[model samples]
Target: MDKIVLKNMAFYGYHGNLESEKSQGQRFFVDVEIKTDLTKPGQTDVLEDSINYVEVYDMVASIMTGESCNLLEHVGALIADSLYQHFQGIIGLSVAVRKPSVPIAGVLDYVEVVTTRGQI
Candidate 1:
């Protein structure tokens, strides 16, 4: 299998358990990895023969910005599910949604939830 990975794609959204978070919003980061057979695209060197990454990016942006979720797990699942449903070539989909500004007591880089779907 081959991978098409989009890392640290950023967006601002309302995604948190706190009331202030929903109103104020914050920056969120997402990482998506799509697994599939890339042999054909590698050989053909044609855009149509491979997954269109721009479309994937746009989809991610839509998911991140369009809706509000309380948990990163739900956000991640939505992305993975959308990818699997919209793209036929994707055999496995993994998504990581990161809340960089989560209101934790101590210092931390970010809090994230990773979700994977499709055949094992």
Candidate 2:
């Protein structure tokens, strides 16, 4: 079980339960881990034998740019689903979406939602 981790991919998007949050938008971070067999790629050193992570990043970026969700959970779930569908080689996946400046008045680093699918 090998894994490819994409961490701290940042984006600016409008996603929140509040109308002001949605209209104003905020910086979001996305982290994703993809589990798959890396034996072939490791042995042959061929790009085709392994997943193209650039494509993965592009896919994530596209999703964030194209859609709007009210909750981090929903965004995370959609990312997990889309990754699973787009990459047949992935046996498992996890996606985490973080909203740093949530409108709550309390002092906190960020709010995050994680979504996982397939055989964890």
Instruction: Tell me the spans in candidate 2 whose CA falls farther than 4 Å from its real position.
Output: none
Candidate 2 backbone collisions, by pair:
none
**Candidate 1: Cα lDDT at 48:** 88
Best by lDDT: 2
- lDDT per residue (tens digit) for residues 1-120 in model 2: 899999999998888899987788888999999999999999999998998999999988987766678888888888899889988789999998989998888999999998999876
Can you write out model 1's per-residue Cα lDDT over 10-99, one digit (the tens) per residue? 999998889999899999999888998899999999988888989999999998898788888888888899889988788888898888
* Clash totals in order: 0, 0
How many backbone overlaps does candidate 1 show? 0
Structural similarity to truth (TM-score) of each candidate: 0.94, 0.95
Q: What value does the lDDT take at residue 9 in candidate 2?
A: 99
Backbone clashes (count) for model 2: 0
Error of 1 at 77 (Å): 0.7
- Could you tell me how far off, in angstroms, the CA of residue 118 lies in candidate 1 after the best superposition? 1.9
Model 1, 7: alpha-carbon shift in Å? 0.9
